[model samples]
Target: MSDEVIPETTGLRYFDEWLIKKFLFSHIEKRIAEQSIKKYGASPIYLSERSQSISSLSEICKRRGILTGLGDLDFLQNCSLTQQHGARSGFVVLGQTFDKNLGEALQHHAQLIESGSIQFGSPDTEQQIAKFVEGIISPFKDESSRLKVCEDQALDFLSTAWDLCRSLIRQAPGYEPKN
Candidate 1:
């Protein structure tokens, strides 16, 4: 698919710095440390200590006005997420944009869920998916069911993207993309 055809919302700009950070913390950093140790016989302790020292220095530079910490943090965090997604630097830009779009989409979906238009779960299900969706869209109305539609749509989009990536990787050799 052409780059433009991949909805800007589906790429990576939809994610914010904080969400990217959470993604990295949840998925990437530890894997990178593990890989480094396995490939180079590097000591995790030394690697972690150096990483911490570099991070501290970066913070100091940021505080001293030598660098914009926000940009650095965003770059580092996004880099990690992109790496985890097996996306290249160009794709990282796309992924960051997609992440931003995803955040906006989620916010919009949440609004719908809170409105009560999207109910799917029930007290018996114990899943609370319906209730969670309702809570997200509730601000629009004290009682509504329209939000469920939007939530389902968002979930579908995420599912499709996951499937597409899996298919693409399976079709290509040496498919891993570097950050």
Candidate 2:
């Protein structure tokens, strides 16, 4: 809500950056790329070339001390999904916080996966992530099952996310925020 971090762990919690990166972001990106290539004739060659170019450029910058690659923390700080981008030149960087109830649900899901009760990317996990996104944009109604994000908040979040994605697209091997 406010820019301040929630003092109580039960109030709001940031998702684990590593988990978000590995399980959420990376998976989503790959899925999108695959779908795009299949349905829209997106060029894998372009993606490969771009990735290679970025890697090479990043290495050079790292050696020159002009670049320090973005880490999970950097994403948490700089591309926090919690805030609106507004007219900001850079991505809204803050800790992406969500309701604690959702956090608990995700933890339970993780435990289920660990015990092999559910498989990652299964329909179960897909539904879980869908609900997770719903929870992100909206407040939990009746144990976090209902999507209730206000229009303004939803717009803000989408715009902010778009900006963050753009920034990420422009990011190199070692991305240093200009701001």
Give each model a TM-score. 0.21, 0.18
lDDT of 1 at 118: 36
lDDT of 2 by residue, 1-179 (tens): 11132232342255444323333333334445668899988934333322222232112142655533334333433443332222233322233336342333223222111111335767589777766666556532332221233455678999999999988877867776677
**What is the clash count of model 1?**
38
Question: Pick by TM-score: which candidate is best?
Answer: 1
- Write down the worst ten-residue block by lDDT for model 1: 105-114
Q: Give lDDT tens digits, candidate 1, residues 88-148.
A: 2223222233344333322222211112333346444544665656566554343224346
Counted clashes in each candidate structure: 38, 4
lDDT per model, in order? 0.43, 0.40
TM-score of 2: 0.18
Error of 2 at 139 (Å): 8.4
